[model samples]
Target: MHSHPRLPPTALEDCYSDLRTDSPLDDNSMSRLGSEMRHGVTSVSNKPKSADAFFDAWIAHVNETAVYGKESIDPTRSTSYRFIWRSWCKYLASSQEGPNAPYTMANPLLAVPVDVSRFLASGMKGSKPGRAISDVTRRRYYSVLQRIYAFCASQAWMECSPLDTLAQQDIPMAEKHTGSILTPQQWDACTRRYGNPAGNTFEIRDHAILMLLFKLGLRPEEIRALRVQDFQIGIADMPTLRILPRSGPAQERTLPLDDQSAEAIQNWKRVRKDLAVVINTNKALQADFNDDRLRAASDTLFVTRSSMELAKVPLLNLVKAHIERSCSEAGLEMPVRMGPQIVRNTRLIIWLHSGLEVDAVAVMAGLKNRKGFLHLLDYCSESVKQKIQPYRRRDDDPVSVTNMLKE
Candidate 1:
């Protein structure tokens, strides 16, 4: 049998206590065990062959947990977690010592806390050397590893998670606010260039997307999830866009649309239909097409020129590309980054400056209450700030001091 060092006496005592109790270990107890076992000593005698099986089981378990027993999960979030885990696994395989040398994958829960810290501090492989990742990204990496370790403990794979020893200070603090909102002039320039009605099919489609994002404050996910049936037009009251609930905290709400936004949607629909028909009728591509593709194209409001479903990432890329094009055409400096959220932020700031009630703005933005919209206040324009200057009394004003002296 391969010999491994025994866990500290404190860890053994806690393990005994855990065995004596019917209740599962809480985070605090697990944290105590983690601190005690930070040296990475373990006595599990499984061979390298069994280690592979354990690794596979651990991965499967993580996938199941993340999906919440559902058939599908969010692709972006799942990919991020998997990437971070694989990076840590590689580090462990290269850095493991003693008899476990190459078998770190077999017992990943035994990773040292200091090693985890080092992995976070080190620059990612494809990134520029010495250019450390952003604090937000490091936090996400730590969060993914912490969750995995906690899961392993729950499944009896480890006595505690080594990640519990990770210090809060090690996770750098992000800036309090980093908001980007376009001015009214910038928005008009962007619309004139990329969203012009005279432009081609792609431009018209992008224009409609930008209108929905800026005018109605719809999120990218909400826009991507939109269907042809969601637009209610030629009604007794007014044309409205029904935002269906997606995978977030926002609820479903139908928003009244102005003439500009309604017209943009109508123009895009005409162009989209023409593209769909051409793709469906082409005999050369018929063999490659399937029923699912046809159904998605017909039911989904937005589609690529090739008639494929337009997912969130591609939709965002389209927005960014058009914004860049618009910036160049208008001779304006392109934003460091632009996305659907920026458009949403710009709209919210506009509403606040327009003197719209916070409650009304929140409802239009699909937020639960006015408080939810407060975070976007940082994007308020200089004009808005100047508008409030009159409310404050100047330090030199004689009325202020004279009234106080008289009293």
Candidate 2:
């Protein structure tokens, strides 16, 4: 461990300026950044009296170590976090300039406790365009700041941390769960009406997505991350879905697919090509892409083709659209809050009542740690208890998904 007065910010400043302006540095300068960190550094910490000095160093630390719910082996997505932190720094740099300047930046590190919450809640204006992030995105932003500030406290940069000083009302609470949980009866109505698509723009794709969320309980990111090749089904074997490591909390894991869900996916794959052709030829859709990311890696199960909405908007909003349509077409009532999460919770609760051991259910639900699993305790009250039955392998029923699907 080492502790000393902060290195002059210019040392880091000049390094990045040269690297950025020069448009790629020589081997020596590259080495200096460490493989551009430790020369392959996994960890480093610098305690700065002012918060500005902490930005680059703290980013490097998270690049080396961020994990999912304190459980994933893969690090948190560094690129996205860096862009976000840069915005925070700009916000802090401009903080003292605003008429409502919250505090002096005599030492910005020291002012974190007083100013961070305000900065996050404030929406972007001008060049950035649009309103601030949604509740989901806001939680992610809070998590990123919390991670660094926690480190700041460990290095004794600030006493405790801003999060510790804020009153409960001041802190952002976990976003509320979307609407009520779906009962098996409601889900039956939703799923039963949606058979193989007859005629719709993305009917096959929509049905496949609903099956994954409602039947298999995958998160939206997990579904979006799936590749055309991730679904594996053979003549004799039941289908399985592989959830790959994605940008956010989704970690790599595979799940068993129920018979109906697998069939739904296969049906989509048959027509998936037609949609790809639309994205390829539709100038409006093609123009929306700023990069060749989707074109270059076209294997993703749910291919994204536009910035009409941001990274997640297309998928998340589509779930709401499809589920609402599904329920309406079937003449069933829609949940007050419509999102993929409600679709997922319905299926997961079904697993719980099916008597899959709680631990097994945790793994299936992608809950890597107990803290992530504890929230489910709310649905486990006594009234629900009488309905849950024991689970087992029937000697005659070799297909697990079939038995699991039997309600």
Q: What is the C-alpha local distance difference test score of each model?
A: 0.60, 0.56
After TM-score superposition, what is the CA distance of residue 267 in candidate 1 from its true location, in Å? 2.4
Clashes in each model (backbone N, CA, C under 3 Å)?
0, 4
Q: Which stretches of candidate 1 lie over 4 Å from their true place?
A: 1-134, 137-171, 174-177, 192-194, 249-251, 276-296, 311-314, 368-377, 381-407
Question: TM-scores for all candidates?
Answer: 0.50, 0.48
Assess the local accuracy of residue 134 in candidate 2 as a C-alpha lDDT between 0 and 100.
Answer: 72
Model 2: residues >4 Å from true position, as ranges?
Answer: 1-180, 198-201, 248-250, 274-296, 303-318, 329-332, 374-377, 382-407
lDDT of 2 by residue, 183-209 (tens): 555677777755446555466777777
* Best candidate (score: lDDT): 1
Instruction: Kindly list the per-residue Cα lDDT of model 1 for residues 28-106, writing each as its tens digit.
Output: 6446545343224322223223444444454565455432112223444455556666666755555554334443343
